[model samples]
Target: MDFTPGPQGQFPGAEAAPRSAPPNFIPEAPQMESRTFGAPGRPGVPVSPQFGFVRPGQIRRCIHRYTFIWLVNGNSFWFYPTFVGNQFVQGFRWRRNRWEFERINLRRILFFRCF
Candidate 1:
């Protein structure tokens, strides 16, 4: 029993019909001019100067064997141990060129471990 339709059995009037253009058509590419925010002709909004804290030859020291240092907020530094299949023990924060000991909150730390 063949269930396939023959030539006249498909979409009754769509055979070899002419296709219309797509619903949306653009004749030419839109023009876009590159301009800076505070340029001469553009509105001058006071843009805050962007700068980085770590200088070219800045020296960073990691206190512990399994710890690493990260520059925070481009000013202060944060030192934390690399998690190795266990809960984090302790961390440190360096601010104003001084190292300060920071205790890890066990509750928040455990929450992340469970999830």
Candidate 2:
């Protein structure tokens, strides 16, 4: 009873007669239930910790800095760049989760400017 197609594009073991559907073909609308807020069964969980920041208005700004500085596992490190008088200089490098001063000329990198 295998209906595998051959290289000539013809079914090898398919039947010539057509197939018919069932007698009871009743199609009904899908049963959908409305969900209410603060439902116990819902899988919604709090995104951030509630104890840290009080209200939504208290949150100021979110910063995402990505600097491609490879140390051990090829990960970018973030270094704060500040303008000093007429010239810009690299302030500090965030190494070991702490700020460390580094002598880097910010004037050379004219494209990167953070206000």
Q: What is candidate 1's lDDT per residue for 17-58, written digit by digit as tens?
A: 112221132222112234324433224322222311222121
What's the residue-level lDDT of 26 in candidate 2?
25
Off by over 4 Å in 2: 1-76, 85-88, 107-115
Q: Please give the lDDT score for candidate 1.
A: 0.27
Candidate 2, position 24, lDDT: 22
Which 10 residues in a row give candidate 2 its minimum summed lDDT? 54-63
TM-score of 1: 0.22
CA error at residue 2 for candidate 1, angstroms: 81
* lDDT for each candidate structure: 0.27, 0.29
